[model samples]
Target: MDVFPLPLARIGIIGGGQLGRMMAKAAKRLGCTCVVLDPTPGSPASQVAGHQILGDYHDPSKLRELAEICDVITFDIEDIDTETLAQLEQEGHRFHPSPRVLALIQDKLTQKQAFAAAGIPTAPFVELSEPSPEAFAAFGYPLVQKARRGGYDGRGVSIVKTPEDYDAHLPVPSLLERFVPAAKELAVVVARARDGECRCYPVVEMCFRSGENVLDLLLAPANIPSSVAEAAVDLAVRTVEMLDGVGIFGVELFLTETGELLVNEVAPRTHNSGHHTIEANVTDQFEQHLRAVVGLPLGVTDQLSPAAMINLLGAPGRRGRPIIKGMAEALAIPGVCLHLYGKATSAPFRKMGHVTVLDPDIETAKRKAERVRDLIEISAEDHP
Candidate 1:
C-alpha cells in the first residue's frame, strides 16, 4: 500500500527505552505523533516524545489510557500484560502484531516449540519445570538455561558448563537446550507488511563480549562465505514467515562448525542487532517498523554501506551521571555516527549509546568501529 496520504495519528509506545525512542523518531519522520507510557520519569523515549504517561506496562489502567487517545499501540517490551492487551483489542483498540502473537512468544519454551512445529531448524530444547539431578543428567553437562519470561539483554540466560553449576545456575522453571558450539552468531532483521509481504536485511555477525552474553560488535553483511550468508537469510525469512508477524522481527541464528544454521532466538520488536541499519541501510529498522505497523508498504532492506556498530556500555565500576569521554577522538574518524540514549544514570554494563562506522568494506568498518570503541569510555562520577 502506498503511504502518500499518511495519517497524522498518534502512535502509542508501551516502553520508553532506546528502541521506543528511535521508533518515535521514525513516526515523527512520517508526520505522526508519539506518546510514551513508561514508569521512568524521563525515559529515553519520553525525552523525545511529545507526551508521556507515567505508569507500569503491566497496569491495565495505563493500557486503557494509552489506547484511549492513540490510534494504534505498540510495545517495546516483551513482558507487557498480554491479557490486558487482548481485552483492549476486543474493546476496539488496535495493536500491531496482536496479543496472540505476544502470547505465543512470551514464553521461551513455547517459542521453541512453535519453531519445531513449523519445521524450522533449531537446537534441541526441553522444558525443565524443576531442576533435578535426573533432569540435569538428561540434558547433559554444558547446557543452556533461559528464563521462560521477562528475559532480555543477557539477563535471563545462563550457561551450565559443569555438573556443579547444574542446580546453582538453573532458574526455578526454565528452558534447557544443548549448548551450541557456534562458529559464528549471525542475525537478520526482516520486516513483514500486514499483507504478508516480507523483506530481509543482509545477515549480520554479532561478536559477544568475553564471557558475557552482551554483544560488543554487530557487523552487517557478515564476513562469511556466500552460501553461509544465504543460509542465514533463508532461515530468518522462514522463521518470520512461520509467525503471524506484522512488523519488524529480528531472527538470531547460530552458525555451527559444520556451517549449519540454527535458530537462536527471535525478537518481535526492533532489536539491538539491527542498530547499524540507521546509518547503513536504505530503510532503518525503526522506520520499517513504523511502515509495517501503519499498514504501509515495507521499505527496501538494502544495505547502503558496509557498517559495524559497537555498543557503548557503562564502565563496570562506575555509577552516577553518565559522562562520555574522548568524544573528539571518536568523532575525528570519518563516517562515524554516534547515538546516545538519553539515560541519566549509569551502571555496570548498561547500554548508554552506540556508534556506527560505515566504510567501503566490512574490514575497514570493523577497524574504525574498534577505534571508536576504545577512544570513548562510558564513565560516571559522583553527583546528585
Candidate 2:
C-alpha cells in the first residue's frame, strides 16, 4: 500500500451538536481545522471547533460561505436543505455522502422506497397520503408512524397500536410501518472511502429508553449467535456499499425472533450508537468519517475491547444551565470514559452527554455502564 499523505484540510460541519463536536475533535487530531455552521452562536460544536458560522442549515448564503472557506463539508444532521447543498456541489464544493443521498435519506418514506426498490429487507411499510384513524385501521393495528422528514431523537415518530392510539399519530406526511416485535436492535457503523473501500465496525446492540424511544444503552459486539453477528455485519456492509457513499454510515437493524435481519434505518453520518468506538475501536467512527471525506484510506474498524455506553439525558423537569452531579464518583470507576456536550441549557430528556465503559468482559462493561448511568445526574442548576 502506498503511503497516503495526510492533507492539511479545513473541514466544515453543518450542525453544531454533540456529533459535530466529536467530529471536530477528531479532525483536530488529524491536523485539520473545523468550522461549524449552526444557528446558535455558542453551539456544542462551536465550543471546540476553530470557528462557527452562525446560520440555519437551510441558509443558502451561509452554506456557500462554509463551502468557500472549507475544503470539504459534512453534516451531523439530516434535516439540512439539500437543494442548497446540491447547488453548492455543482459549483465545485464537495459534500460527503453527496446532497443527493442526504435528500433521499431526509425523507423517511423516500428512503424506505429506495431501499425496497433496491431489494433491501425492511419492515412492511406504506406511505400515508392521509393518515386518518380509518386509514391506520385499514393498514392494521400496531403501526409505527414516522414523519417523512426532519424527525430525530424520537420526536417525529408515533406508535399507533390500536384505534385509540390514532389521536397521537404524527400530523404530517408520514409512513406507517408494521411494528416488528424485534428480539434485538443492532447497529453497524460502516466507513467507506472515496475509492469505494469499505469497513464495518462490530455489531452493537441498542436498548432504547422506555416511552422516550431514544437510545439509552448500547453493548458492543452484541451478544448473539456468531452466525447472527456475521449476518448482521454482512447486511450492514452491503447496505452502505449499496449507497456508494463516502464517510461513516450507521445502519440500524432489527433482529426478528424468527432469525431474520431487517434494516430499520440508515444514518449518513457518524451515529450515537458508535460512541463506544471512541474508546474500544482501533479507529473511531469520527476519525474514520474524516478520513473518508478527505480522501484518505479508511482506517481499521477492529474493536480492541468489549464496551458498553449509556446516554446521559437531562433530568425530566429540569430546564436551565445543566448541573452535572457524581462526575467524581463516576470517573473513579475503572474503564469509565465520560463526554459532556457544552449545551447552554438542559431540557427534559435532552442529550447532555454520554459515558462509555470498557472492560475485558462485555457483561462487566455493561454493569459498569449501568452503574455510571445511575451515579450521574443531569439537572438544572436552578432546580430546587
lDDT of 2 at 239: 84
User: How large an RMSD does model 1 have?
Assistant: 1.5
Question: Each model's C-alpha lDDT?
Answer: 0.89, 0.93
lDDT (tens digit, per residue) of candidate 1 on 1-384 = 544555567899999999999998898888888999999999999999869999999999998999999998987889999999999999999898788888888888999999999999889999989877778788897888888988888878888888887655754788889999999999999898889898898999999997557999999889899988887888888888888778888899999998899999998889999999998999999999988897877888889899999999999999999998999999999999999999999999999999999999889999999999989999998886
TM-scores of the models, in the order given:
0.97, 0.97
| lDDT (Cα) of model 2 | 0.93
lDDT of 2 by residue, 1-384 (tens): 555345479999999999999999999899889999999989999898959999999999999999999999999999898999999999999999899988888999988998898888999999987778788988998999999988998989998888987899988999999999999999999898998888999899999997999999999989999999999988888888878888999999999999899999999999999999999999999999999999877889899999999999999988998999999999999999999999989999999999999999999999999999999999997744
* Candidate 1 regions with alpha-carbon error over 4 angstroms: 1-7
Candidate 2 TM-score to native? 0.97
Clashing pairs in 1: none
Clashes of each: 0, 0
lDDT of 2 at 172: 91
